[model samples]
Every structure is written in structure tokens, then in C-alpha cells.
Target: MVERVVATEEAIQLINKLKSIHGPLMFHQSGGCCDGSSPMCYQEGELKVGASDVLLGHIGGSPFYIAADQYAYWKHTQLIIDVVNGRGGMFSLEGPEGKRFLTRSRVFTEEERKELQL
Candidate 1:
């Protein structure tokens, strides 16, 4: 099955580290005006999710979500979560770790899209 979201090795390492220190984690794709499309990391359930948030999939065993409205703009692409040097959103757990989660994407191919029923 096609995964709508996945993490890179660097990201997985960081996620594991964060999990060790913070326990389970989750990711929410930030909509614009601040962090842009930055992936904000938080302890699992730190931020409540509901019908308005779409579960894109998981990365490094962490559930990833995007606002239902934002999903409409990203439904056709795969979200690649990566790690880089920088501070993330103030509210994200990773902000204090000197590293931030980044969201990169590529439009799904016809076959990939079909596999995902997109």
C-alpha cells in the first residue's frame, strides 16, 4: 500500500530520540502564516485531533495529521518528513532540541495515486 507520509533515516533517528525523552510523539502539519508547512512534533495527544484533522499516516511510528482543509491541498502528494538543523514552532517539542522537522513532498504518479485511491 502507498503511504501518504514517511520519514527519512535522519528523521527517524531524531524521532526515536525524542520519543525516548518525551515518550510517544505525533506530528501535525502546520498550515501557513507562521511555520508554513513545518511539521510540528508533540507528545502523543498533546494536541487534540478530531474530524477536522486528517490522518495522513505515520512516520517513525508516530501518527501524522494535517487539517482536513489542508489535506485538500495535499491529498495528491506524499509528505516526506525530514530532520534539519533549526528551531521549529514554539509549541513543538523539537523546538528546544536544536532540530526541526521539515515537510517535503512530491506529487504522486498516476500509478501511485491510483494505488492510494487518490
Candidate 2:
């Protein structure tokens, strides 16, 4: 069985706020800068899950989904997403043994940060 890391309380609140306007929250990770880690939120139906998909449970009542392949890689990963205050939003992942990586974006503008608040 695949293990799932629960979304933090802050993440849950942020996702709920986004769902109020955008509907279900969609999550995806991909190979990119900062040790091959990336995560983004989109409007409902923006993401398509394949047969091998893994349901990661809901974050603040919003369905949180992820790809099976990606889950395999993130099995023991920890993610921290922040949007509160004016510090912009960022996504970071740390492996089981403390290895960590941040999103590729050097800095997020006000609008961009708000858009990806969750």
C-alpha cells in the first residue's frame, strides 16, 4: 500500500479558500529545477487522473489528488506551502532523511502568489 502524507492545517485552510471560488483543488508534481519538484493548483477539471492514480484524501473538504508515480517518489516527503501574509507562496519538499528542495520560482509576484495561495 502507498503511504500518504497528510496536508498540513495551513494547507487545508488555504485549499478550502481556493475551492470556494475555484471548485475542487487539483495537485500535480513534475520534474523541474530544485531537485525535480513542482506543485501547482488549478481550476476543477484542469487535471486528469489516470487509472494508476492515487487519491491523497481531501485538504479542507477539497479533494486532494496526485499521480501514483509521483506518490511513489514522494512517499516520505514533507511539503510546506505558505500563502499567509505578504511573503508570497512557496512549495517545498523534504525527503525522509532531511533532503529538501524548493520550487523553481525565484520570487512570486503579488498576483502570482495569490493565485497559487493554496
Number of the top candidate by TM-score?
Answer: 1
Q: How accurate is candidate 2 locally (lDDT)?
A: 0.47
Span of 10 residues, lowest total lDDT, candidate 1: 29-38
Q: How accurate is candidate 1 locally (lDDT)?
A: 0.89
Q: lDDT: which candidate is best?
A: 1
Off by over 4 Å in 1: none
* Candidate 2 residue-wise lDDT, 9-77, digit = tens: 556666666667667666655444442344545555676767776666544554445567775655444
Could you give the C-alpha RMSD of every candidate to the true structure, in order shown? 1.1, 13.9
> Total clashes, candidate 2?
0
Location of the lowest summed lDDT over 10 successive residues in candidate 2: 92-101
Question: Which stretches of candidate 2 lie above 4 Å from their native place?
Answer: 1-3, 31-36, 76-118
TM-score of 1: 0.95
TM-score, cand. 2: 0.50
